[model samples]
Target: MGRAGRKTVLFDEDKPHNRVTQESHGFITQDGVKPSDFKKRARTDVQKYPSVSIKEKRVEIIEKSGGVFRIQTKEGKELYGSM
Candidate 1:
């Protein structure tokens, strides 16, 4: 979305897949980077774009209609987006 100059919202909850698991490997310049650090760097990069925003809440449901997507969060907030 950043590449296309479109505003974007990223939902991250740090689920099980993001739990501490030592070091992450197999990326070109980021091999052996700590998982937490890697995630921080990724978030930082995304934040570099003023059009990008991050949401730390878990999504409860997502529905698509009329070429738009409506997402509901566990906190009872709803978000809508269209491509």
Candidate 2:
């Protein structure tokens, strides 16, 4: 963010709380809001930035030993990550 995002960080939010209702002591403004609602709002806010790409899929394999990691996607998309 200091000088534009140079790399991507694949964040894992697999269990993004399928069912929950309200949080009252953490975030600002949205105090006592539904968890799902808060996630929706958070995702929306994050997605507003062009650099972020949200992928809703299970991470099958994550081998980080070599200089790069070869990630195999469920949809068969092989992504290489610098290690």
Candidate 3:
């Protein structure tokens, strides 16, 4: 979406992967890659876009009203967006 000039925010809770030590397969060019390494590379690629942002917050609730989305985080931050 960011590549299409749309503003996007990804919320991450920083949770550990259940199979962190195992290699991930099925992804082209990323087969056999570790989860942490894949995430690092993917984040780097996404961050290159100015309209994209990554938020290190866990979402508590998501409510939609009047075609708008309201996202509430566990840290008491609220964000609004529309599709």
Candidate 4:
């Protein structure tokens, strides 16, 4: 969506990787890559888009009324988005 000039927000809690000792396979050129390294590189690529943003907060609630979306975060922040 960011590539199409739409605003995109990604919410991540920054949890630890469960596959720390495993290598990712079947990803073509990224075969045998570490999970942490792959995530770091993917995040870097996503952040390069000006229309994309990353929020390091857990979502508490999501409600849709009328034609708008209301998002509430665990940290008491509220955001609104529309289609």
Which candidate order results from sorting by lDDT in descending order?
Answer: 3, 1, 4, 2
Measured by lDDT, the strongest candidate is 3
TM-score of each: 0.83, 0.58, 0.87, 0.77
Candidate 4, position 25, lDDT: 80
Q: What is the lDDT of candidate 4?
A: 0.87
lDDT tens digits, residue span 50-83, model 2: 6666777666776776698877667766777672
Tell me the lDDT of candidate 1: 0.88
Name the regions of candidate 1 deviating beyond 4 angstroms: none
- TM-score computed on alpha carbons, candidate 4: 0.77
| lDDT head-to-head 2 vs 3, winner | 3
Which parts of model 4 are misplaced by more than 4 Å? 16-21, 25-29
- The 10 consecutive residues of candidate 1 with the worst lDDT sum are 14-23
What's the residue-level lDDT of 11 in candidate 1? 95
What local lDDT does model 2 show for residue 12? Answer: 52
Predicted candidate 4: what Cα RMSD to the true structure? 2.2
Instruction: Say which prediction, candidate 2 or candidate 4, comes out ahead on TM-score.
Output: 4
Candidate 1 to native Cα RMSD, angstroms: 1.7
